[model samples]
Target chain A: MTIEEESGYRGKAEEFLQVFKKGAEFTQDLLRENERLRYRVLELENSLNSATAGSGPDSQSQALIQRISELEQEKKAILDRIQQIEDENQDFANRYVEIEAENNNLANLYIASYQLHSTLDFKEVLQIIMEIVINLIGAEEFALMLLDEKSGDLQAVACEGLDRDEVPPVKLGSGLIGQTLQSGESYFTDDLESYQRDILNPMVCVPLKIKDHVIGVLSIYKLLLQKDQFAQVDYELFTLLAGHAATAIFGARLYSDSERRLSTIQGFLDLLTK
Target chain B: MADYNILIVEDSPTMRQLISFALKRIRGVRIVEASDGVDGLKKISAEKFDMIFTDINMPVMDGLKLISLVRDEPNHKGVPIVVITTEGAQEDRQRALALGANDYITKPIQPNKILDVAKQLLKLA
Candidate 1:
């Protein structure tokens, strides 16, 4: 009875060992296959990374970045150019305004000269001269004096802001007015701000000349309250008046005398015909 | 291209011409000259003027009187008046303003100044 039972137990133990060996072998094969598959997956991932970095996405992105940088530079340069053009335009606009002001001053001179010679009547000529003095010269007190050929003295023919008696006869080469007439050059005060109303001593004296020959003198005793100093155009006006006013006055006097003689001759003719 | 009629009342012909030359810078402005306040009044009565520039020391009726008379007329109630006065005559300027002058400009005026006053008063561009 003991021998048979021991033999059965030994056969069963051998069958169990065979099953355990088969299970261990299958586990080892699975581990080996897993390791090989892991390596394959790593290789595929690296190839994909290299392919993308070599020529596809990375290069495209780099080109796009370079293009953006270039565009930014171009935009900055364009903006700079635009700013320069704007500055130039502003300069031109300012110059245009300056020119416009200069043009107006020239027009004033032209108008003054044109008006001075527009009349032939003696009263009208005198009135024009007075207006030229007050408006153009900005003189509040002034006198226009003509030289007396026989007496060798200057007598005021037209006086403003003063009575005729206030202006006495000035001997040639005696006072400021006489010196202005003698030299045939303009005389201006040293300091216009300190000028006051003086009938004897004038602030400015412009000799009326015809080709370097002084015929009369324009004496300005006081300027207007608004006029502190002479402007650049005022000197031009003085020069113009010196020549034009003298010629205009002389021409007007001659025309007036001739007109009166013509009237007298016409009257005599009428009387003879009658 | 005359749209506005402006009257300039001045005693001196040269002053009138100068004022006219200055006023001509304004676009669409027609200028009318008058010798004195009396003549200005006559012209104002005869025609419809948009504005008036007058001297303070004009002969044959002062500018203040002319302004008052012009303001008395209902048709001229809206008309603007600018007085031209000497720089020293501040009292005259004030009197003119009190008598219905809209503004005042001193003598020895610049053409640009005259244009500015006229453009502002006339509402011109």
Candidate 2:
């Protein structure tokens, strides 16, 4: 494709992105309207709490009764609309699942990338990565380790299933995690039989990379009890983590460093004054 | 105003809290919570509740079974039962209604929906 055609394609993509963002906003509005109608109906119903057939024939009570019925009908219509929108959302989620199962790896990759880097907070970003692995990848017994550049070891930074205290820092170029760090590539082995003997052999190891350089490794120790085996989406998520996770980690780390520097400066000012 | 005793049967603490929170806004409601269907059934047998709000998916027994058992009980024949279900499980909701649930609500449970439905079904009906 020519550069001109590439720019045109990029323009179309941006238009589509804006359209979807607008659609999300519209969905939010519908949700709010649905909530308002719901409250309206509830208020109308609560107003009739004192109504009984013995005292119901009065003009004011008759008006309340008519208004209650009208509100009920209106509520029904609003609920129907809400249900339709919810059905569409459910359909989209179902299709997403199907694509994740069949051949929607690219979409999965995009979503994983979007979610991982969507936050600037380091802890939240790590939490999102962990959720993606557990919810999307269907894995358990995982440890996310960052490479200690000066010490040449992998330190356990975030973990689940495996106790953080029990996990010793692994030497660089020692095992599967080390191998992924050195190679700057993802390595996944479903060889359950072989992994039984090698305690350090993670069933899956994806190196977090900044460009070609490996920064950290997410080691999946095993599949969860409910999940029998890994699927195509898991590998795509691994690839996404390999690329986008590094950027998010670096961004968060940079923010934390700046915050720490500011705190240190404030401390120095206070100490000098004292 | 007559007092209404409502039993909430759900395993997830967050969901139970949400349901309780929504129900508490209405006047004349006394809410009791059971973590699972088994616990709900035991409560149903031991005490008298004006209404039952149950979630479908639980560890020991589900809402359908709870609904069936509640319907089967001679004492609780006319009690109002509401089925709380996930979005994808329309079939289960239908089954619960068939098993004699008075109404249904989908999850990400809306506060107003619960309030309106509870008022419509449980109060002055």
Candidate 3:
């Protein structure tokens, strides 16, 4: 559910909690009064025996017994209502906790999405992609590699928590990352061969596709200590970023290219003017 | 070509490199770099610059304060200032322009566009 929808349910749950809490409090108060009445019943019964043995019971004593029985019935009903409301409140509290967790995840997704498109600057896009991987995905070691379209090679553009010198360029149809990108498939570490898994351990390589053509790869190397394994939500995020991130990075590359040409022309124009 | 001294104020090394590299494509332009607004303010006070390019959301101080502070200086009035900011930050862009920033561009900065504005502001070709 969306955050807005969850918040609406949360409001109703809070109101429900308050009403049940009030009902429980009211029932407790009645229980205290009922206990006091039961003690008073003992006194009335003692007096009734005396009056009955003396050949006439006061109407007030008989009336007191009837009132005690009525209060007993009311107390039983109140106790049942309190128990039912308490159970419902407990269930509501659990559901609210679940919604809270979902809301937090959704918020994380929103922030990541916002940051991904925050800039079109080539260098800035690289930084943002790194931040999104580290902060949002909880990956300590990750690499952002761009596909050299002309050479059909995967070259590491940016990396974190790993050695840059160790990142060898991969040809289009090579092992792991390259193979997945060539086939337009996502590769998870669980399906990796033992020898092929030495590098990018426990990694997920998502292809950056624009117009269904894979342009780059976002490879997550090592996960954070807190995260044992990737979750369903991580897969969803991977799917989201594959297209959006690739498109942005491609645009940045094109922008930078135009920028270089413009600078040359502008410089030439300025020299002529001078 | 007019020899111009430009100050690039940004937090990222890569962004600084990109801007500096682009500026170098033109002739007779000297570029100085500062990491954030506080450093930018210090440099602005220390030396004369033909133009200033700054970014928002930095540690210590921010671009908005830097622009206002630079505008408040006696000898720095009417100098051209360009703001490099995030794409979705229109409110900030408008605010910077209102605060006497001469022009603004969203990132990724098209280098030629910056050169164009620089030429107009400095009355070059």
User: lDDT of each model, Cα atoms only?
Assistant: 0.87, 0.79, 0.78
Cα-based lDDT at residue A132, candidate 3: 64
Which residue pairs in model 1 clash with each other? none
Model 2, position A123: C-alpha lDDT score = 92
The Cα error of candidate 3 at residue A5, in Å, is 99
- For model 2 the TM-score comes to 0.45
Give the DockQ (2 decimals) of all models.
0.57, 0.02, 0.03
Best by DockQ: 1
Per-residue lDDT of B1-125 in model 3, one digit per residue for the tens?
Answer: 44888999988654565566557656789999999999999998998888998987678989999999999987688789999875557889899999999988655343455667777877876
lDDT of 2 by residue, A111-219 (tens): 5677777788999888777766754576667888888889989898898777877567887787887888888877767565456523367888899998987888888
Q: What shift in Å separates residue A168 of candidate 3 from its native position after superposition?
A: 1.7
TM-score per model over all chains? 0.82, 0.45, 0.49
Residues B5-86, model 2: lDDT tens digits: 8999987554565567668867777899998999999999998888899988788998889999999898788999998875
DockQ-based ranking: 1, 3, 2
What is the TM-score of chain A, computed separately for every candidate?
A: 0.72, 0.58, 0.64
Error of 1 at A13 (Å): 23
For model 2 the local lDDT of residue A233 reads 59
